[model samples]
Target: MTLVDFATSSLSVLPAIIALGLAIITRRVLISLGLGIIFGALLLTDFSLLESGKYIFNTVKGVVIEDGGINTWNMSIVAFLVLLGMMTALLTLSGGTRAFANWALEHIKDKRGASYLAAFLGVFIFIDDYFNSLAVGSISRPVTDRFGVSRSKLAYILDSTAAPMCILMPVSSWGAYIMTIIGGILLSHGIADYSALGAYVRLIPMNFYALFTLLMVFAVIWFKLDIGLMKEHEINAEARLNESHKEDEDHVDLHDEFGVEESEHGKVSDLIFPITTLILATLFFMLYTGNQALSSSELPFSVLGAFENTDVGASLCYGALVGLMFSLITVFKQKLAPKLIGKALWIGARSMFGAIIILFFAWSIGSVIGDMKTGAYLSSLVQGNIGLHWLPVILFILSGLMAFSTGTSWGTFGIMLPIAGDMAAASDISLMLPVLSAVLAGSVFGDHCSPISDTTILSSTGARCKHIDHVATQLPYALSMAAVSSVGFIVLGFTASVLMSLAASFAVFSMVIAIMKMLSKR
Candidate 1:
């Protein structure tokens, strides 16, 4: 009803578009985000340069501190990133990385296995997308690197598996959050046919983008279908690996930026133990926090209930702290000098500085987007105008656009889910799940394509890939999956049959992949 109340009617989209274009063209993430933040601030401040400066400062302040208190969620995530970086350094210093790589080389025996390992790790770590991206990247990077798999490819694998897998599993933070939203939506619509968890599970078959994107990950690897820019990256990765082998023995590891030589006393357990501790500790805290939360509320202490109420940001921070301790213990066992350990810690924290800066700017712009009502304005454009049968498809596209513009999947969910539920309930009760599922599918798709997204940034950081390179290479795959899923949503809206829609989507996905593989051979 009050679309674009904060700024210009259509100018709200300009900042995001400018940011996205600059990111792709200039290949400088921070600059792009900075410019976007400035434009958004100007728009929010009615183009007054001085006022825009104030707006920017206040917005950034809000991100760091809310209601005169620390933004614990945001700050905790930042801390986790720093801790994870430190843990990674310790892994390297203790020679755990090298030993793990050597072990992978001997056991995997080929690049395909390495690729599968990356994909497996990505899917296996589904508790939170942030954790999934960073942990999988750390665990799989050494193996993937030894096999000459491109860092961009590893990032792609991480980005694809992290959010999609988490969104589908009820035990995951994503799933729990989505279910809570769905519960409110269902109650508001007065629908009694299914519970929130039940609705989510039923919608799984209808979430074409998430399902298709996931299968596409394995399909791309199995078919060797590296389309578009990805092929060139794979070629360059092999060349780089070959060139490294021919270099003299004096070649130092590029990641050893601290000038502290890694110890030769590292073993496979050095890598495994700390990482395992991180995972287990994170999971434990999630339940622990969730259960504690239930004690303060009326909710019972079921696993799903705990997950639904868990403090993800705090849990990740706690987990990282514990994991770092394990890494420290491992490093100490090797008798590495104290100076070297401190240097490793410094390198670890410093490596995350760029990511942290980008994240802050990204958050700042997101706040500006919210203040500008960009998402609300975008959703308003299609409301009450589309036919009922086309609602699902349109919502999927709309949700994708909203998420792409705002650079957040959860934000898109928050905005679109209620609108979708209201629309479906008013038109046809049968379409509720379809439309709601479309929004979920589209959000994940959009988040994948967005360069400013936290998941995208973290994926690149984890893989040690250039952020722009990862974005450029992953774009084609995301768009390809999105294209096929769009067609499926269209069919779904008309037929209202989950089985038929899934059958059609997968059928088309298979054909598209087959044709691409055939073309590659030629």
Candidate 2:
């Protein structure tokens, strides 16, 4: 039953193609992924319809629950999601988010300041992308609304910062997950000299897309450069606010779960304490897990070294569980009814149900892709065609397409890193680092733009913006940064100097922002 040994070359890529085609045409990720899995199962069963049906049933079962599947990692994600959800809900019920917004409103005076504050808060919460998106939107949405900042804009700030910041911060969940994959790839390709953390650190400066994307947020805020559908949305939001009957205008429920109702019992500490605890616990557990693993391996133990050796899934689960406990204690101290807390926790977990289902299907499809060796097949197509001068940009473009099509940057990372590592084994470290950085940057770029992406969905939901509106308004900004990042990657491919590439990229970003500002005025 080792499908990789028996997979037909012709049918290997068909499932992925079908899945992408269906996603674009139908705009339903669950259905597209399900169909992809069924088609892949059929191919595995040699087109025997009856056996294919049975195989589909068994495959999904194994992928989700049985040993040697994605169950271990997938369940860790699930636990993290549920715990984070409960924390958000507890904060909401205690009115900590509203209180924080009110406190923030005292200092953040205008629309521009509000936008910058949102961006700052988004960047501040970098432990987890999901937490960043939800926390930024929930806390800053009210303040942004007070200053006539559109929901679309809020969503943009949240979405833009979430992944980019996480990918940039080595202490983040994203960093740990990606490093694990990269480490495996390096070991598998026989690159024994380089450690995963070392490689990741080297790739950081060359992460043009993330750096440019973060800069774009600041530029957009500072220059007030609203264009395309964003301009229309902002104008419309202002109009609605002006015509409001209430002078305070705090009762805006743009969506079911958004908007804040001020509560006298709410305290800013309620919000601050849980988040602080979450961060501390996450970092602590990461080191703790790393130390445990390292002790067994007889490796020299340092905090940074521990991170390189840590079990990311286990650490995340442990941190989330502890964070949940702290949040519950805070909520109980606020004298909220036990039943109400329980209800809020359930509601929060329920809210994550859709994300969990998408993750499940994503993992299932990944299993199929692994068996088919789809990434290897794609790697075969480019074996020696990519010259050193073009490798970085080419990898960027390929990773971008893959992530955009699949709507999962993590999946893109899983697929592309090994190929990049294998390429590196045949080449040099200078080439490998930049190419891997390109892959990481491009993955975030595509995820930032893809409407079907989980972060995109969560951001829109959190901001109470129309999902399509969020995508349409944010596309221009994302594409602009992507264009700049591409140029930077190209420069790096040729020069192999990180400093030169970064300077060139920043120059491009500045020029593009100036152009955008000029266009906005016209």
Highest lDDT against the true fold, candidate: 1
Cα lDDT, model 1, residue 236: 75
- RMSD from true fold, candidate 2: 4.2
Q: Measured by TM-score, how close is model 1 to the native structure?
A: 0.96
Candidate 1 per-residue lDDT, tens place, 236-301, comes to 778768887332222223364455466787899999999999999999999999999999997778
lDDT by candidate, in order shown:
0.87, 0.77
Candidate 2 — what's its lDDT? Answer: 0.77
- Residue-level lDDT of model 2, residues 146-226, one tens digit each, is 778888999999999999999998777688788888888877776777798887887888899998899899889999889
Error of 1 at 518 (Å): 4.3
Candidate 2, residue 450: how far the Cα is off, in Å: 4.1
What pairs collide in candidate 1? Answer: none
